[model samples]
Each structure stands twice: as structure tokens, then as C-alpha cells.
Target chain A: MSAPAQELPRPGGFPEIKYKRNIPKVGPSGLTLLVGITALCTFGLYRTGQGNLERRELEREKVWARIHLVPMLQAEADRDTYRREVADKAREAEIMKDVKGWKVGESVYNSDRYQPKTYAVVP
Target chain B: MSTYREPTLPTGKFVDPTPAPAESAHPEVGATSAPLKSAAYFIGAHCKEYNEDFMLCKNENADPAHCLKEGRKVTRCAMDLITKLRENCEKEWVAHYQCLEKNNQEYYACRKPERTLNECVFSKIKLEKVIPGASGTPIHLRTDSIYS
Candidate 1:
């Protein structure tokens, strides 16, 4: 029997397929920069939230002032006028305490106490 | 293998990206360094109740004249308390007024029931009545002997 013919090798062979692994790398400085950025962003968000809260609170206060404080101030003015009136009446009473015999038109008018305080308004 | 590249900031382009602190954070700015203690604080705290009354009146669409009566009572009562506070807590009141003159924000910020003002007033000013509920009827319609 003739010797088996040797298997012939292919002429132009295809390049062998090769797989390469690539690992991601981050340095110490890169990690520090990332942490800093995240912290700063978090702080910024917190401050913005705080500012918004305060602004809303301030607006509420302004509205309360407009609705309540203004009218209350006016009422306070009226109360002040009443207080002055009461003071004047008290002063008049204290001044006339020593007077004994007094007539409504004659003797009452003659006394210095009945002459009215210099600052008092004449009706 | 690739070598790590350092990030470079351009000259004259490096800027601070942080926000400034709030005014409340800096107490040393002005008169804000000191706490407030004033007559208005005590009375204002009490006025909250009266304000609720006023709001209720408004909600009911009550007459302005009637609503004003309630407001008048609150104002009068507050003024009376203020007089007492001035006489009793003179030192605190004076300090607070000075703070107000120096800085309005500090003054306004101090107007709280929990502030030193309330402490001063509550300890010093003695009062028979706290909140005068409501002033009923108009001034002209009152047939009280005191009016006559």
C-alpha cells in the first residue's frame, strides 16, 4: 500500500484572533477631585434650599404685616388719643381737689386750676 | 498601558464656586451680636391670639366697623402692656431700642416670644388680664354709664 499522503498546510493562514483586557484606572488626585465636586454640589443644594425657605417665610411675614400690622397701628393711634384724654381728665381732677365752694360758671372759672392747663386744647 | 494625566486649571480662569454664608450666620456683623429684649416682643406674642380672632372675623365677612373694634382692643391692651414693660424692664428695653436703631434686621429678628425680651417682660410686668377676648358693640351704641 502506498504511504498515506501527508496533509498539505493552507497557503495563506488567517491571523489568530487575540482578546486584550483593559482595566479602568483612577489615581488618588482623580478620586479626591471627584469627592470634592460631590461635596460642593451637595453643599450648594443645601444652601439653595435654605434660602428658598427663608424667602417664603419673609413673604409670609410681609403679608401678615400688610393685613394686620397696618390696621393695628391705626387702632393704636386712636388708643393714644384716648389715653391723652384720660390723662387730661385726671390732671383736671387733681387740680380741683383743694377747691371748696365752687359754682359752675362763676367761682369755678375764677380759679387758676379751672383756667385750663396752658397746653390743653380749649373746646 | 496608558499613563495618568493630571487635570490642569488655566491661569486667571480658576474661580471659587462656593456660595457666601447667610447674614444670620454672621452675628458679628452689627448690633446683631447682642440679643433683643423689648416691650413689643411680649405684647406681640400675645397679639397672635388676637390676630387669629381678627382673621376669623374677616373670614365671616363681618362689618369693618366691628372688626376694627376687635383690633382696637388688641392695640389698647398691647399698649398697656408696653407701658408696664417700659417701667419694669427699662434696661432691656433700652438695649433693644439701641439695637433696633443700629440695625433693623437684628431688631426684627429679636421680636420672638422665645427671645430675651419675653424673659424680661414675663418676669417683670404684672398684669391682671392676659387676652381681652372681644370688644362687643360699636362705641356709639354703648349705653354704659361710663360713656355718659
Candidate 2:
């Protein structure tokens, strides 16, 4: 009987196929790319920081300018109040010219009850 | 049924109105906010003494009447500064303030025109914009800033 078919030898050899893993290495171009990316990122961060700082400066200046002008503005408002008081008095005098014993701006009520209450609830 | 009666108005007593004399009276600064903000720093520089005096008067006296004269002086000083700025740096000042008016009165946005105006004012009147209580170099003087 012929040798068992399972024991038959394989056919003539072709070159063995090898599968190799690729390991990434940093060559000159790769190193240059890495450096370039790092630089760009750092510059972007720096620019953002500078922008924030400038904005802070602007805000500080605005607030300080307002603070500096407060007294002057308050003075202007006070002047307006004075002028309004004068105008109101003049208008009242004109309106009350015919009324006998009529006075402008004087409190007519003598009792504390007539005074406007300062607080909603008594302490 | 209750009868309805007309309510009588109270006759309030009057105090004599004390108006400032014609010679001493000064016209108020007519310019509004944008213009005022544009020239605020220069006004402060020019009218430091008057501003301080007015503030002092207000602090010393709670009565508005007592500080009226000082207030007038402050107003006059501000008016004078505005007039002088108009006379000397009209083009630059207008450009700066118009830029400010357009930019919601933000100083940084108008720094280009502001720089020009500041240069003109400094050259003409020798008044520099100095921010009070500011630490480090002023933002206007810096060249390295990325944005205006």
C-alpha cells in the first residue's frame, strides 16, 4: 500500500513571508515638526495671556476714571438740586401770590404724627 | 350717606432763594458723556487742584449751598480744559472722541485715535494722560501689546 496521504511532504519552498511591526522614530523632519508644533502652541498661549492682561488693564483704567470723576459729578448733581430747589420755590411763590399767610416749603404739620415715617415697622 | 368735600392743599413756607451773583456764575459744561470721557484724563491733569478743593469743600460741609462756589470752580475748570482742547487739538480730539462714541466709549478700542490725540495734546499743552493709582507701565505707552 502507498504511504499514508497525511504523511506527504509539502511542495517546493517559496520565500517565507514575514510581518514586521513599524516603530515610529523621530527623524530630522519629525523632530522639526514636533518643535514647530510646541512653539506654535506656546505662542498661542502667550498671546491669550497678553490679551487677558490688556483687558484687565483697560477695566482697571475705566473703573479708576469713574472713581476720579465721582466727586465732580456729585458736585454737578448737588448744583442741579440747588437750582431745582430755587426753581420750585419761585414757582410756588408765583402760584401762592394771592393766598394770605401762605408760605412755600415750610412744614405745615406740627405734630410728629404728620412727619413721614422713615421705617415701615417701629423699632 | 357721607358727603364728599374738596381736599385743601397745604400752603408751605418759603425760604429766600440764594442764587449766585451774575459775575460769579459760570456756565455748565455742555458736552455730554462721550466727549467728557474723552477729555476726562486731561481735565483731571489740568484741574487737579480745583477738583481737590471742591471735594474738600463738599467733605467739610454737608450743606450743598456751602459747596456751590467750589463746584462752580470745578465746572469752570473743566469747561476751560475742554475749550483749550477744542482750540488746540480739535481734529485729533474729535477723531478720538468720535471713535470712543462709536466704540461704546471703550478706551482700548480707540487707542489709535487716542494716541494721536494724546500726542497732540502733549506736544501742544504739555499735559500727559496719567492714570491715577496705576501700577507698572501705562498701557498706552506699551508697544508689545497685540491688540489696540
Candidate 3:
């Protein structure tokens, strides 16, 4: 009446298992879709960033928009107020450099002690 | 032309990046780079902490100089720090502005902290504290002190 319940495999189990194995285990590749989505998102971020940057720039211009037009005009009227306040020695130094024809954009980058230095970290 | 990359140095062949051989593999005890030892660096590093005590981030870099919005206690401290930065920036401008001629290299200059008040013991004393206006105290009272 029972060869044994455990031994009763009336279904086609062996072939089914082989068939499953024969089919690749990997899912459909989404490389193209992933690339497309990433590209679109990156472009959108860049576009949004452009507008945000513009807004920030405009805001910077508007801030202090009415802060002190009169005071600023008065300060400008004094013209050489900042220049005159400085000692004659300082003025001479500036003039001397100009007379010597030192170009502002010249290689004075090396002469400035405060010039930033490059750092190389040890491995 | 072969684009040469420095191959990983093996063992004894390790090349030190320093121009001159370092006196020691490690910087001497208590040694700090001069750039890392500036007051601006110190303040920038502790900005958030200091701002908590002093109203900072009151405005991002968008605000004009000297237009301090007076309200937050932390803002006062931040303004003090910003004032110092602007004053001493001429010395720092060359390095901070010059060295990295390309890209956002200038920002790297603003990233150091050397003048920290590590040893100072700070205590909060609330004076003329503005208690939130309750229904009973409809009018805001300005006491002689801002301390709460």
C-alpha cells in the first residue's frame, strides 16, 4: 500500500529543476534605462542650478539696494578721502610702483608673502 | 608619450612628497603649519559653535558688510569674527586668493582654523531676558539686561 510516502515523486521534478537552471538566473539588464535616467536627472540639476545661481547673483545686487545711496555718494564725493587718509609714505609707495610700471597682473604672484602655497600630502 | 603615473612605492622605495627629507616622519610635537595657525581658521572651524552663542548665519555671504541685523546674541559674535576676517584678509588675500589660480581654489583658503579659544571658559549670563510675551504681559518689556 506504500512504497513509502517520501519516495513518491509522481511529478516531473528532475526535468523541471534542470529547465530552471538552464534559464539564466540574471534579470533583464537595465543599463540603458539607468543611463538615460541618470543623464536626464543630471541635466535637470544643472539647469536648476543655473537659475538658482542667477537668482543669488540678482539678490546680491539688490541687497543694500537702498542701503545708503546718499552716504555712498558723499563718500565718493570725497574721492580721495581713503587715499588722503593714508600717510604720504603709503601714497608714494603706490605711485612708485606705478611709476616703475609694475603691472598689477604681472608675476607679482610670486612676490607676495601671503600668496597661497600648494600642499602635497605624504603618501 | 606614456602618461606616467607614480607607481605605488614598495617598502624602502617610498618617496616622500616633501621637497626636503622630513626631519622626522611625523611633525614635531606641538608643531603646526603657519597657515593652519591663523585666527581666521580658528574662527571658521568653530563658527557653528560660536554662532550658537553669537547669532551668526544671520545671513549667508549675501549681506553687505557692516549691515549687521541686530537681534541674535550670536550675530554679534559672528559680526565680530567677520570684522576680523575682513580686516586681516589683506594678509590672507594673497594666499587665499592667489595660490589656487584655478577653479574654486580660493575657497580652500577659508577652510582653516588656528585661532580657537580652546582655553577660555565661557559662561552664559542672561540679562534683560525677553520672556515670551504671555497673555498677561501683553506688552514687551525691555529690562536693563538682555540676560534671561
Best by DockQ: 2
Candidate 1: misplaced stretches above 4 Å?
A1-28, A54-71, A76-123, B1-41, B47-72, B106-114, B126-148
- How close to the true structure is residue B62 of candidate 3, measured as C-alpha lDDT? 19
lDDT by residue (tens digit), candidate 1, B12-96: 6322232222211111101121222233334455566775676576456433333555655666565555556657866766666
lDDT by residue (A18-113, candidate 3, tens digit) is 544456647546997798889999998987786565444333322322221222222222222222222333434554564565443233355523
Of the two candidates 1 and 2, the one with more favorable DockQ, higher being better, is 2
lDDT for each of the candidates?
Answer: 0.46, 0.75, 0.32
lDDT of 2 at B126: 88
lDDT of 2 by residue, B1-148 (tens): 1135456543764433556444345567878888888888888888889999988887776556678888888888888888899899999999988998899898878888999999999999889998765657787777666667
What DockQ does every candidate get? 0.04, 0.23, 0.01
lDDT of 3 by residue, B92-143 (tens): 4334333324323322222221001221101111112111323332111212
* Residue pairs with clashing backbones, model 1: none
Give me the displacement of residue A14 in model 2, in angstroms.
7.7
What TM-score should be assigned to candidate 2? 0.68
**Model 1 CA lDDT for position B27:** 13
Please tell me which predicted candidate would have the highest TM-score against the true structure. Answer: 2
